[model samples]
Target: MLIITPQELQTDRLVNQLAKTWQEHGLDLETMLKTLREVRSEYTP
Candidate 1:
């Protein structure tokens, strides 16, 4: 069995909005992923 909570739904909506905004600004998936990796590494140490 699986259940989706309200917070999860809201998070999904926010993620979709971010993706749309990124696309509107001409960001591609590869670039977004690379940026994410770089940011993660910066905070990981």
Candidate 2:
């Protein structure tokens, strides 16, 4: 069995809400991967 505190529950809810918002805005996997590659190219030695 596992226990979750109120704060943890709230954090999880917030994360889920943010994820839903991102999906609604079309922040899909391909967009995220492209952004990550661009950022890495800028900062990598």
For each candidate in turn, the TM-score is 0.54, 0.49
How accurate locally is residue 17 in candidate 1, as Cα lDDT from 0 to 100? 92
Candidate 2 on 1-45: residue-level lDDT in tens?
999675557889887987888799989767888999999999999
Off by over 4 Å in 2: 1-18
TM-score of 2: 0.49
> How many backbone clashes are present in model 1?
0
Among the numbered candidates, top TM-score falls to 1
Candidate lDDT scores, in order, read: 0.90, 0.85
Question: What tens-digit string does per-residue lDDT give for candidate 1 at 11-41?
Answer: 8989899999989999988998999999999
Task: Itemize residue pairs with steric clashes in candidate 2.
Answer: none
